[model samples]
Target: MNKIFALSAGTLLLCQMGMAQQKMVADKIAAIVGDKIVLRSDIEGEMVNLQRSTVDNTLPPNAPCMIMEQIIAQKVMVMQAERDSLPVSEQDVDGQIENRIRYFEDLYGSREKMKEVTGYSIYQLRERFRQPIKEGLLAKAMQDKITSSVKVTPSEVKKYFDAIPKDSLQFYESELEIGQIVIQPKATKEMDQYSIDRLLEFKKQVQEKTSDFGRLAILYSEDPGAKENKGVYILNRNDKQWDPDFLAASFRLKENEISSPIKSQFGYHLIQCIKRQGDNITVQHILLKPNVTRNDLAEATKKLDSIRLVILNGKMTFGEAVVKYSDLPMAKFDGGMLQNRMNGSSLITIDQLDQPSERDIVLLLDTLKPGGISKPMPYIDDQPGGRNGVRIIYLKTRTHPHRENMTDDYARIQQRTLQLKQAEARDKWLREKIPTYYIHVEDEFKQCSHIAQWIGSIAKQ
Candidate 1:
């Protein structure tokens, strides 16, 4: 699991104290693994975070013990990663930062709101999270490296399942296999031209000093993820998250230069390059998506409905229809099947279908039986760079609640078995590796049962 290091209340309080010129107690070292020191503040910070995150806002009795052990494990992995010279690229770090920032933006509704609540700008937050995220990624990479070769055979999987007591077997909810044939509503050429013209006007205003680019972005940018930050972004030339057209336009500008309206998949943008540092550039932009009119939606719906009729009449298979007509790049490539993000399987539970954005689709799915297809339905694609569209849902299969079994849930069982095998391998590796490194825990935490192995190993050292 990847660990996210969030700023806890304790850290915020310390920051506030510092800003007020108040003297605060210094943080103490709680433990040391090799040359890595885990500070008392780190433990307290995590404890506070865990307490706040729990249902009743309380930490478990053994929370400190658990947290400390996890920290020790992570530190040990980090030491090994460093020793082995594990590589973490700058692009990977930037990607993580972007994802973290996007998550907070969703949570707080906007970057400005997040900054107001957290008392830190997005850039500052990224800088603070940079080291921790990098270290966490390194630790995870090391763990994966250690467990990469561990695999469970068919016999081992059956043995693992047989070993589980009958009463303790896991129960699964009713799951559905769903697929879709999507058609994106496209704006008319006139509407697209209007959007470009509007952005061009905005560019003129910015160049003439009649309006501020950032101010205009805050007011007019449709890129919700960046609007609250005045549409600011620090982008690398090779970052895949950016649209090629937008990226190219951004890189073409000189410092303090504004570009003409550029059209990308997301929409039209007027970009102002703020600064350039080698391959990295900071730019401010205002985005405006072309108006996808009701006519556009109706046209898309009609097209999807026609495709659905052809599939139902056996003139074309659903997968063939997906390949021929679907505009969704990712789903089209996979025959329009919707896979569970957790397990990377097409099987999804009804409860998983209860997400607010998927409620309409769930209702449509309720009317569908196995191998059934629904009429084209309207849905706003909530994905990044998504737009309003119509799609026909395909219900491929649905399974009922059942105990763990080979026939109904072989893939899940196999995954669980493999995980157990990998965990055993990880423990064996740790046992062999820990003694080679310098390890110490605080005297107070020596009572933790899991720490005994480390303590014993230290004694041997």
Candidate 2:
């Protein structure tokens, strides 16, 4: 099931549980919220990705009947959110939009190509998606309201562990202990001026031809992924993954319009709007980041070299330097530590490291035993706003696979226990609220085995 999820989603926001045989679509005017209509498409689209990978590809009358009941219940909660004037922030939407773009980018390959295939620019796709994404996020929040209060005592966890048969227990494939140091090179005045000068010249050329925005992107844009997208990205209304300045400026453009140079931490961008629909827009952009020079990189490396020497000489410790110098906020509190992002395990496994850091760290660690330090070396972390850096790391500790026990796996166990509690609470909420909503399951599904549980009180047997 996990493998199926990976194949279908690779990081899609949708959550799925292993279910069996469910293939059906309906066009019922299921319910209405003030001015909005809830069609079968809305409910079923939410589950299409789920059913695609579930063990049961067949749509049992029982499962659809139960899910339809849940859908109507979700609508009621969304309606309540509207009535209460609950709001979602633009920051959140931008982040979500970016995440969706990445998913589809992975799905379709290249943002521009996705635009060509989907027949909607990234912006247009995102705008159309914005409301649905918001609706989904809001619905989840509402679901949380019902399930948030559920809690499990220590006894519940022991019971949960006991309930699982010995052979049925889940064993993690592996774990790792990792140490890292990072040094970020500063952008220089000359490189910044050069990039700004190029944009200024490009703006002149754009003004001269006006019809060749796409052509210019092909020739000069440095953003490799989006350039393949023809310098264009779709904006979805509920997308939450974009840089804010990028999102706002794109939406503000008029059709066939070129925007002024927009600068962000990523670099400089020149935007051309291809189309617009309400809050969403499809726009192409050329990005040029000032590249760090050899001297600038050398300076950062030199600094790390000094730190490495000090630690090796016993003047200072690697953890102390990490506390003093690492810029990553998430790593700062952990003493500039490197952990497997998948599970936050201190040791990164061979398969877990995707960047050059994995090989570099392994080689560095091979030369040192526990409590030993590595020389300053270059490493790259694939993160937004991540850049080339040099740092020294210390091998803190290492662990090997063992039977799951309380001392080493407390956090993972606690989370699973909480999830079990939450699932039960959601079921309890459905049992109580199912009768209150105006629900009318298709008569074909009414006699299914699960229908009574979905709609609360059952008729006499």
Model 2: worst 10 consecutive residues (lDDT sum): 1-10
CA lDDT, candidate 2, residue 27: 61
Candidate 2 lDDT score at position 83: 60
What is the TM-score (0 to 1) of candidate 2?
A: 0.69
Can you write out model 2's per-residue Cα lDDT over 28-81, one digit (the tens) per residue?
A: 765543455656654465456546657877555444545554555556566655
- What is candidate 2's CA lDDT for residue 71? 54
After superposition on all C-alphas, the RMSD of every candidate to the true structure, in Å, is 6.0, 6.5
TM-score of each: 0.74, 0.69
> What range of 10 consecutive residues in model 1 has the weakest lDDT sum?
1-10
**Full-model lDDT for every candidate:** 0.79, 0.64
Candidate 2 whole-model C-alpha lDDT, 0 to 1: 0.64
